[model samples]
Target: MSSSSQEPQLPVIAVVGPTGSGKSDLGVNLALALNGEVINADALQFYRGMDIGTAKITVEERKGVPHHLLDTMDVTQEASVADFQKDCRAAILDIHSRGKRAILVGGSGLYVRAALDVLEFPGTDPKLRKQLEEECESKGLAPLRARLEELDPVSAARLGDARRVIRALEVHGLTGRPFSSFMPQREYFQPALQIGLEVDREQLRERLALRVHGMVDAGLREEVRGLDAIGLRRGKTASRALGYAQFLRVLDGGMSADAAVEETIVATRQFARRQLTWFRGDPRITWIDWQDPELVPKAVQAVNAASPASA
Candidate 1:
């Protein structure tokens, strides 16, 4: 065999889309059809006992296909995309070495990109970060967000919270460049295929509402109650997760259970819109209708077409 033929064709597939878009089930189907194992890129799914809120696939749901990187962190631990990039890359490599396809699955846009793109994260300075945090505390996020908008309108427009706004400011303070400038370009670090799932906006809104109601019925409040015992509120990242955050308000008597569920549904719909915007900006993705019955087959075909041998 020629040297090119002798080299292994490692499969790196990423299934990405909005919440309630059937990404997890599609990923599992792809894995089963393509001899692949899953590496989670969902930031929320990394926390242990965060099952109900994050919609993490249960053991029975995974259907014997091995999954990596799920439930690996405590609720009190901060989840870092940089750290996830390292861990996910290692997991992908290990899966390839074992002669299996590697499936990267999640709705976390940056996390998925960090796994497959030639992206570099700037180093953090503790003192600077602390100063920025203090500033946010003493003054307000308004000043920081305004500054970010002036410096990097793109990032400012996308980031909605104070913590992330502060981090962007910290990046600018440290690097002397707009945080938007550090955004990943359209370059892949590995040979990979990205599949995106999309749904009609009205249908998606309805689906999200139903899903949130289902989660509440499935004991999401109880899940949060359990995590509260483990100091979930102390975790910078985990505490801010969509469903968890809303339910925490309910648990604190700041909101009613019914109100919490409604709020989570709205927040999730907005989040899904953001996710769709992020993924749609990337032209490399092969988008499929989420409700298509032939979704798995179409995804499999896309994967095969992406393989070098098929080229």
Candidate 2:
């Protein structure tokens, strides 16, 4: 007796958590169990040749489950949330058309939100951005940041760093709207079930530190050196990636590998804290202990019991 319009909207299965929490593995498992494909939501994974630092899954580890959106960009190209939203939705639609589920995976907060929530991106003006950057350089960030404070206090408070502040100013200049006004609503753009991996704080800390050391031992410095030769320094997004930045200093002879290792570990831990805070603020996500031995079976159960999505 129900109309077609009342049918459940297609669902997106998202696995999200702090870094080093096994999101990628869970994603692969969920995809295989559900006859699905994973669509990476991690921003850093988009760049090609960023394997070592990103801890990207090897081909063999993927178990032949097709992953979309990884290695889609050169190191030099900027990662854009807007572009990701468009591309992720397209991937979801394409997968659904084939009667396959789409598993969204990553810990990138805003990027994950962009792919799931109702968010509007303000248009950008390159000239205005350049003007703002020039002003920041010539006049210093204080005046421009102060200007943004007056025009968009919300965004001014939330945004940090020169690049972000300037981008906020540029957004206001172009749209005549505060950048914060475009914040994502919690409403889902389609049916979705978010799975969060919960881990012990101390345990995760140890894991992250060991993980960094493993990357270093796996030739992270060599990776950085090769990437630097290829102009990684000119890559805004890739250049600033977690471990890559610390190692860049090592390559510059300004730091020792040991020093960079410690610094990268600290920075990565901080980044993980920030990620945890961001994802924890959303009540829509269902959390599971990362150590659960029955994780895959429970995830499959969640998907099956979820009231959204057809086949």
Candidate 3:
């Protein structure tokens, strides 16, 4: 470490929050003010044809801010957290090399965490994945959870939930080691400054509802139709995006558009709540009250505090 009092320069500035929390707008504004380039952290935004549903910022919307990591993946391709971390690191370094700040903007907390932290996951074993998939079809996730509990209680404890438990167990079955052991205790690699966006539950719900309706009006169904025509299936991650999943139900005649939109609003609100839960636990974050009257000034302060002294 340097003896000087100045802070170390870091590659990225991540602006993260839940959907419709004004993250995109704030990121764009901050980039304009700070001489930064935007790099998207949202998973769904990587799909090329997913526009209105993913709430992807267009060129006009980005206001020529030079956004990266958006529209970089094919809709059918699997884009994992590891892949995103590597890609984002490169993008951040590229921005820094260009003498510009890297602003990471999105609501995907897992993606943001993976990008900023040094994550370690178990080694991949395709045969094990296949076997686990077969077993999931045969017995269920419960049996896998039990196996994981027997093999590695520490990992099981950390991954108590169904989704994580299954994944952890699968990895253990493959690698013959606990998955949690792979998690890196990464030090703060960046002088990161986090800004959490906020809105009232009711207002957010209203916004989500309106946004879903607007997406439908903006040809979301047609977008899905196009993806389907291009062979993007329901099992793919892109197809499971909030609006896409709900609209797929609509397409299948399982639910009406109105009902789907209502369900989507509920789901999105729950997602926002979960995001808030995750972000609130991080002490490193300095929350900016976007709901407050002096949001701009507070945002500016956040930027200044986040910037390296040389900037």
Candidate 4:
């Protein structure tokens, strides 16, 4: 460690919060204050032409802070946690090399952990995945889920749905280890401080509803229509984006536009609740109230205290 008198090494500062809690604004301000660049961890924001639904920040909103990892993937591509880990770490290193801090911002808990924590992503084999997929299709998900319960009860209980069940089995088959064994620890990959935004439940619900309405006004319906033209439904991840999924129902005649809009608001609220649960479970995060008048200054204080001269 260097002497206490020298400037300390820059940490990868992370600004985390639920959707519509102003994470983007806080991230941009933090970057400006800390001489940092923002690295997006939101999975949905990774896709091109996914701006409106994901509530991605515009170039003007970025306020001249260089943002990385946005719009790097096409809607047709799957967003992999493994791939994101590799890319996000590279961006952090590049920023640090250039003597700038890296501010990772997003509400995707798993993706955030992948970027900052000591997380291991199990490798995949195509043949193994295909064989397992076939087994799932032929014998049904019951047997595979039962087998997973026998081997890795943790993952079996946690992972719901056929796809995740098959994935767990694949990990066990290839690595001879339980899929749950790869869960991330709280340990940071490098020096880092996570500043989470805490918002009032009732107020956030109101805010999210208004935000979804604003998206509709901002041509979200048209954006979804255009993406569907290019096969949005075929893109597993993109197709299920919060507003995009409901809007697709509008396109398919299963639901009216107004109904889709209501469902999107509800879905966004539920998602925000889940995000809060995930972040609240982590004890290491230093949280600031989203409505705090001096949010930036408080965040900066947390950052400085996190990595002191002795630290």
Candidate 5:
């Protein structure tokens, strides 16, 4: 018997891939086919009044498919993986109760990982995080990375960079334990199928370039101008978002509009590369080359083959 047979099963289809890889389209198609409701796993897509830049699916795009979590949070409020886990669990239960499947979709690797595993993390201390942020501002992230290298070599080695290293150090300083140790040691939740879209690097780059151009034409500059008026400066998570970040450079006289768009496309391509690297480490994810139209039917088969929930 399947190990999952003992638990109250909730049928979930998780569609994960790098940015601009058609993840949303696949999710929408799956939802339509499976009678499922889409629950967003993209962190950036949650903010209300921040639609076009995030490339959020419109009502027409959704084709009347119900989507949860998108447009659910304030731009200023930070949402964590724990909160995502909680929301996703509740959404899945609700979907099951309605006799429908839950389709979780996005390009955010952390969000996808949290949903796929029973993850636990030390409770955060706002003061400690603030202190760490202050330290980062004053001493620079390099010092924090160096400190983590001394204190938790394993984590430092795993992180291998300033941004992640600083975050791990902050968590360690706050929680009085290696930040890595707090992560769930075992798989608590496993999806029946974890589908990943694989696209050729050149193809992905082309898609990204086109998408960036489309965003510019779709008033992305105006959107960033509005965000600037609201004082959403660089370093704020919202401002650091891919499209907004590049546009900010344009508005600040740092780069020409054309240069900014090209830079954004380049950065987005790099980000997608990192996403592919992250998802590649997960053994459960089944990759379907993006050009393969056979992917959807195969995923559908996987879903249908999943064990039914025990009453």
Candidate 6:
């Protein structure tokens, strides 16, 4: 066991992995063991009334541990990692000030990095952004995408959709630098321990499919129906979330509930793969088997080993 020392450590613990990997449960267990509180980093879980689709942990599942940043935004508001970085750091500071360990938990890779890494978000120009948006609306994404490919091929390759492509163009236009140039380095702004859960790929595929089916059974359609009334479709980010986006097709009479469920499962699996690729690129995270029976104890050991005194 690592011993405490007079030299202070920031003492932030992160539980990260692919979707359906039980990160939330592990986070709660680690909190219970280490007397910590959780600060959520999952982007989808930020929306209010998005419980069923996001697979948010219920009150009973929280086991009395205080969770921060869950359901902090309405579905109609756009979720931004830059804004999340501020809120998450504040939550961590407040937790540490209260003499409690801050447990950062979620699968959103960028949000987790934004909280712990030394990342700088570039400033935006409203007028320039408006011009780009107008172009995207009138000429479509291909022209803007082609322009980005010319200016910043790396960013163009990385960004999948029009919103992100346009943002990359805006950033380059404003800063005279490629958006990918702002990629975070492998240094923490604070002392942090990242615990990643590993799973068998085939098993994860099956698990994710079943999980989507479970979400549908848990009234995901009704959940989307409720959010639609609150202008969910108009929300840039929330409207495009995994389960919610697919179910919107059902509401549009474009597909059946079964088709929506299947599409969600497939999309979720692809997303999980992307998440794994992103996390695997970072060498700092300590990976553990998801099925380990002594998971909590192992996580506690990792935390202790990463402490400043242990170092």
Model 4: per-residue Cα lDDT over 124-206, one tens digit each: 98998999899989999999999999999999999999989999999999999999999888899878899999999999999
For candidate 5, the clash count comes to 0
Per-candidate TM-score against the hidden true structure: 0.88, 0.93, 0.89, 0.95, 0.86, 0.91
Candidate 5 lDDT tens digits, 229-249: 766573256778888888888
Please give the distance, in angstroms, between residue 223's alpha carbon in candidate 4 and its true position after superposition. 0.5
Reference-based TM-score, model 2? 0.93
lDDT of 1 by residue, 1-311 (tens): 37645685765899999988888898899989988999999999999999998889999999999999999999999999899999999999889877789999999999999999999998798999999899989998899999999998999999999988988999999999888888898899988899999789999999889989999899999999999999999999999998899989999999999888888888899999999999999999999999888999999999988886733
lDDT by residue for model 6 (1-311), tens = 15433557756999999999999999999999888999999999999999998899999999999999999999989999999999999999889877788999999999999999999999888999999999999999999999999999999889998888988999999999999999898889899999999999999999999899888888999999999999999999999999999889899999998888888998999999999998998899999999999988999999988875633
What digit string (tens of lDDT, one per residue) describes model 3 on residues 1-311?
Answer: 25333656754677876788889988998788879999999988998898988888878988989999999887788779888888888988888777788889988887888888767556576776777778877897788777887898988767766667767877777777788776754445455667777667778778877888888889988888788777567437987788788877777889888887788778877888898888777776667756777876688787776665763
lDDT of 4: 0.93
lDDT of each residue in 73-126, candidate 2, tens digit only: 988889999999999999998897787999999999999999999998987899
| lDDT, candidates in the order shown | 0.91, 0.93, 0.79, 0.93, 0.81, 0.92
State each model's C-alpha RMSD to the native.
Answer: 3.2, 2.4, 3.2, 2.4, 3.7, 3.5
Q: How big is the RMSD of model 4?
A: 2.4
Residue pairs in collision within model 5 = none
- True-structure Cα RMSD, model 2: 2.4
Segments of candidate 6 deviating more than 4 angstroms: 1-6, 135-162
Off by over 4 Å in 5: 1-8, 130-151, 159-170, 184-191, 309-311
Q: How many backbone clashes does candidate 2 have?
A: 0
